[model samples]
Target: MDDPVRAFLEANHGAIMTTLKKDGSPHVARVVIGLVEGKLWSSGTRKRVRTAHVRRDPRATLCVLSEDNPWAWLGLETTVTILEGPEAVDQNLALYRALAGEPEGLDEYRRAMTAEERLVYEFTIHKAYGMH
Candidate 1:
């Protein structure tokens, strides 16, 4: 259809639970994500399994279930880029706050997080498709 990757993300902007094995195989879990600058972004602690997989392999696939038809699904293959610096954190925090609808005191929460503790991973869409 019309760029299923962007369509899927626009329809569902939430965390997407992704699976990545040490061997480089990947699986995707639907999760809430924040969209900014035409990219899909998510945050997680370093202790999480997905975080570990991303650390090993930045390539990931994301899938979102279709609401109009439960039998349908959209999938995207993307390259993940992990942001771990101050500036990147700020940008990601702004996007996160906007997506979360937390207007007040988000800056404080973002400031409390350390650069490493806050993982801002961006998924660059490479290919996308869907099936019904």
Candidate 2:
């Protein structure tokens, strides 16, 4: 990715993630996404339809919009890996911090994530395009 696109991704957290349904239709959701270790990351529970869709199909598209400029945006075509279980707790926390900074109640937040069975969706970019 170019520096400008990387910067745009790092600066924005709100994005639209599109996954494939079982019938090959599209499933889209608004997600809080961030750039971590050169990959795009998002946190979701296993129960969510979007999560299930990704679990079934690794291919996905992420559209990140500029909060300040309506015309500025970035679209990424990627392959996703779902990270869950005990190891995902810390990974999800890191993603949360990257997107929103330190939580006010770190321990409580961790507990909630564990209780909810949260997972991290890691995206590897294959193609990128858009106004950005």
Candidate 3:
């Protein structure tokens, strides 16, 4: 396992397209990610379809490929764990601040979110593979 993969993920916590199955086929969609305590964290709005699918099945695969180098890819297969309530909300806010360069007004943005509106999910990273 390369340590840089984790570092890369933390530094570039952008949208990653996770693939799951529906009706014996595959479905891929982009999602925002946060790195909290070395685990991959994400959330979904109530309107997002992925949230519903995840509830039904927690298994997912996340792929992050380098734009400048196709050969360089980081992939992980893991089970999703949903985190709800106040603790999750605070963790998400902290993650956002860390990955988003600690931008100004972040405190206000985090403060504006209600406890119910924030849904945090983490991937345990059961297995990870990559090529540099």
Q: Which prediction has the highest TM-score against the true structure?
A: 2
lDDT of each: 0.68, 0.89, 0.69
Taking the tens digit of each residue's C-alpha lDDT, what string does model 3 give over 1-132? 358877667655544656455664557887767677666888655446666667778888887666566567678887888776667557777667666756567657666555347777788777887773
RMSD of each: 3.1, 1.0, 2.7
**What is the TM-score (0 to 1) of candidate 2?**
0.95
Misplaced by over 4 Å in model 1 are 1-4, 24-30, 67-69
> What value of lDDT does candidate 2 attain over all alpha carbons?
0.89
C-alpha lDDT of residue 24 in model 3: 44
For 23-118, candidate 1 gives per-residue lDDT tens digits of 656565656676777667777666767777877887887776665667677676778888766666676676767576555676677666663577
Task: Report clashes for each candidate as comma-separated counts.
Answer: 8, 0, 0
Stronger candidate by TM-score (2 vs 3) = 2
Model 2 agreement with the true structure over 1-132: per-residue lDDT tens digits: 789888999878789999999999999999989887887889999899988888788999999998888998999999999989898889988887787789889999889999999999988889889997
Model 1: lowest-lDDT 10 consecutive positions:
1-10
